[model samples]
Target: MQLWRRFTHRLRSRQAGDALLALPLGLIVVIVLADVLAARLPLGPSLLIVAPALTASFASTLVTGAIAAVAVAGMLIIGLDSHLLGTVDYGSQFFALLVVSGVVTVFCYLRERRARELALVRMVSEATQRAVLRPLPRQIGPLRVASMYLAAQEQSLMGGDLYAAIRTPTGTRLIIGDVMGKGLTAISDAALLLGAFRESAHRQADLPELAAYLDRSVCWNLAEPSEVETAGECFITAALLDIPDALPLIHMVSCGHPPPLLLRARQVSALRATKPAPPLGLGELTAAVYHVDTFAFEPEELLLLHTDGVIEARDARGAFYPLAERASSWTLHSPSALIRHLRTDLLAHVGGHLTDDAAVIAVQHTFRQTPTVVHTTDDSA
Candidate 1:
């Protein structure tokens, strides 16, 4: 009885294994039969056969598809040798079958290789993003910060939009800027600007000095000897914010960029700079200095800094998305939540893609807690 049970178990295992392999094998068989029938019909060569054969080849392991191909080729050879078609040359039919099988195999191999390369590129890009945009802590001074940076192209790992926040003896200094163009040159320029900003922010006493420092650094380092004549032409639109410890005020210096958006309860407005400043690198020739604009930041209010990429993003209908109007309804509760909502809404507005790199930083002053109210009865006296 034990031996009988063992034999029955072996048979069941074999059946299960065969069932698992049946669907793909069946598909291959059907495709081969269809090809053979189509070839025999009045309809010339079986070009339709190539589709299923290539699909099977790419979707399954090379060995499995190779086996199927070999089997089909063998069947074709046998059919030809048996003179199945009247007055048709056997050698010619056999050669044609061989050629088709070879072509399908090569195509499948190339496609599989391309897929592997794409996956590798995606993995590298994700890794680079984490390295470049490290997570911001919950709070910086009185401000709660959250930010998002998105590349314009699908496969790109990085681009020109840049932002940085650093605590210094001067104050909590922040920068938001966009490089002139895209690709490797833009990334290079962005890195240069951020590096200069961080170094200068710690050392410089005021916003104007810091701006001048950055301008000089970029002018000296970015311009090639041959491009000296065009040095004044290249510049970055940047906004620098310095939050002082003494009062509930934020000092801002805008360099030809869009003004920061300020959000208070039920009201959203642009903290427009009173004096328009020339962009960095352009002010070197002119002795005129840029002035900083000051605005009050009550607790629970939000400030948004962004790049032109956000303002310039267009939808399928070719209309530019109005950031001010769209972000008006946003409630700044947490940095991550605010950024998440903005990213989703922005992508949806543009229908899944933007023509340029985009970035947004949302900061809220959370130190001044809301006062609690209590009711008192006056009628008791």
Candidate 2:
């Protein structure tokens, strides 16, 4: 049974890996035969294979398709050289090859153009992702950080969910926020929130001031005075934290966001922030004040900040994922490992696409030893 299971696993893995490569391989074989037969025919066969070759190459990696074309060309050359035909028939054969080559060249050109277009799209997506949710550094002073951002929609690099972290003079400041909607508008809101937080966190000394700054920025940037009446209007839920010089202590503020999870000794617990404050853009009506809550962080502790995409992720059976529960059993030590595990679990939970942008940031603090003092009382006396 064990051997069978291993073999089955390997077979499945190979099938998944080869799915994209099959089209080009099949085309290469078919085109090679067509090129050989065309050389012997009275009329040029080059044009015949053009569409098939080009289609195959276009659907797969350029290099693979190119190799197929080279193979076909070589076969044609050999057929012409061998007395495979009554005569050289240079006119017909030359034109046939010319047509074939032209088609190949055109196909390659189109493929290149398509590749450029895709690259441009990807570049724009990446730029947008960065602008919306700037990356957190791997190391911020005494903290080691790792983050992962997964767009629910394939081919998209950025979405409504966002996160950012910076080592400010006040200490390590980080924010994880989720916009109310999805797509371009949500991305704009995310960008606005991150930009505001970054600027305010640097300038404002306290967490409440930073939160207020973010609130004003979002309200001013997102909506006009007329749109404030709607209850379900767009807004952002966020959790912001400041890790000051006094290591193992965190000053946090939560704005209608899920509490961050703290991992210590392989256990997960929620770090309670003050009572829920209205989301960033909605506080304009009541003008509610944001509260700053403090928590102690033990050495070798991990702080996990994530968007609702994680908590709300549902499996095929409609069971929502419990990150804290699942993560409790995870033995991964590093930030990357944690992200990888979380991503895998998330994919398994959703059985495929997440349908929402998901972002996670994990931070671990390692304590530095303070120097011990030695007394020189005898010499001084």
Candidate 3:
């Protein structure tokens, strides 16, 4: 059953491509009709070569060869009718037409093979991205959440920045971070952090504990496999937040990362950390000390957590993007709407290019809905 379905799907996809088949067939028909109508012309079916040339563009190698065969047969008929089939002139024309058609058919086959290989590579890349950075759920407990990732690498869908939301008995736990460097090295570190957070976030009792656990885990990964020496500056800057379902306050911990932005009543403010800690993976010398800072998350307020790639984006004048100022005007919008506006504005500011990987997570606090009570009566009575 699966094989049949796959075959049907491919057939449906090819229906739109029937025009490619029609082009060659239509040209061949015209050549034959023109030969009959314009027999008096000195040229002997010279236009028939067009059929195979057009076929090479959209047809397979086999189809191109078949079209070439038809053209050769037509040439032979025209030669015999013109009393030129046994002459040197006929042999030369036939050889030229055969060489051109054969070359086109081989070239088209090679081009199509390269295109298929690229499509396969792209599929593998997409699968890796999905596993490394899973998509965030739009609705988590009592919060309306939205997230986006913008990669700086060309032809790449993911990079060193990361974010994740894990719901637990306590609250909706959130993380947003950026790892130094780019390409494969940064992406590997980002994936390691995301995996550790998801595994330990719910088990840890407090925000500080969760942060410390992640920091220690990253430190362990950065340490030399066979020795106690650790890699220098191989750290990840991160911010963690916990928003309980029943309160209008948020608990946060920052580790050498930019502070989260709070948008309330058309006002924007940075929720700075009281006692900052060093970035993860540097606990030995720095002895990372995390502190949970409480912030007001009023109703209709939107909290924006983003990587530095956003604020550091530069315009033609080399000025950084004013995220807080511009985001204040979007306080009245929902989480998804605010993200959409920011994405478009950021691209426009940087002239449609980003220099680093960027990630954004917007959490909105809205009015709680009253539970609906359904009352039933005995209709039979």
In the predicted model 1, the residue pairs found to clash are none
For residues 46-80, write the lDDT of model 3, one tens digit per residue.
Answer: 67778889888777888888889988887777776
lDDT of 1 by residue, 117-220 (tens): 98998898778655554445668877789888888866775687888888886458889888787887677677778888877788898998998888788788
Tell how far residue 15 is off in model 1, in angstroms.
20
Relative to the true structure, candidate 1 reaches a TM of: 0.75
Ranking by TM-score: 3, 1, 2
- The numbered model that scores best in TM-score is 3
Put down candidate 2 lDDT per residue, 262-295, tens digits, no spaces: 8877688898765768888777876868888888
lDDT of each: 0.73, 0.75, 0.87
**Candidate 1: residue 347 lDDT (0-100):** 93
Candidate 3: residue 214 Cα off by (Å): 1.4
Report clashes for each candidate as comma-separated counts: 0, 0, 0
Ordered from best to worst lDDT, the candidate numbers read 3, 2, 1
Give me the runs in candidate 2 sitting further than 4 Å from their true place.
1-108, 224-232, 368-381
Task: Please report the TM-score between candidate 3 and the true structure.
Answer: 0.83
